[model samples]
Target: MMNSRNFLDLEEVRMEVFSGKISRAYCYVLVKQGKIKAIRVGRKILIPVNEAARLLAEGVN
Candidate 1:
């Protein structure tokens, strides 16, 4: 059900992707680092599927 257009919640990414070690603030850090893209909708930040893939790929390094 996940597509390139889908946006992931920051909290979900923190738990699922980073395994609870990364905080939401650090998610913003990734954005700042240009490792991912954050879409700000109101007060929440969302990660697109492609950007999430980029972050996951970064773990290989």
Candidate 2:
């Protein structure tokens, strides 16, 4: 099981990763496109911190 601390919500991703440049809708699109790996908990989308790091390392296209 993965700890909740290892995940980030779309808002955090936008703020921390993109510096608030991207919207949540765009993040959702990335999730739908498989560019960002996410797990759904109820209605909340949780993205793995490592995945965010990978995106940072690889650069989003």
**Top candidate by lDDT:** 2
Cα lDDT of all candidates, in order?
0.73, 0.83
After superposition, candidate 2 runs with Cα above 4 Å error: 1-4
Q: What is the lDDT of candidate 1?
A: 0.73
10 residues in a row with least lDDT, candidate 1: 52-61
Q: TM-scores for all candidates? A: 0.69, 0.84
Count of clashing pairs, candidate 2: 0
Q: How close is candidate 2 to the true structure, as a TM-score?
A: 0.84
lDDT of 1 at 3: 54
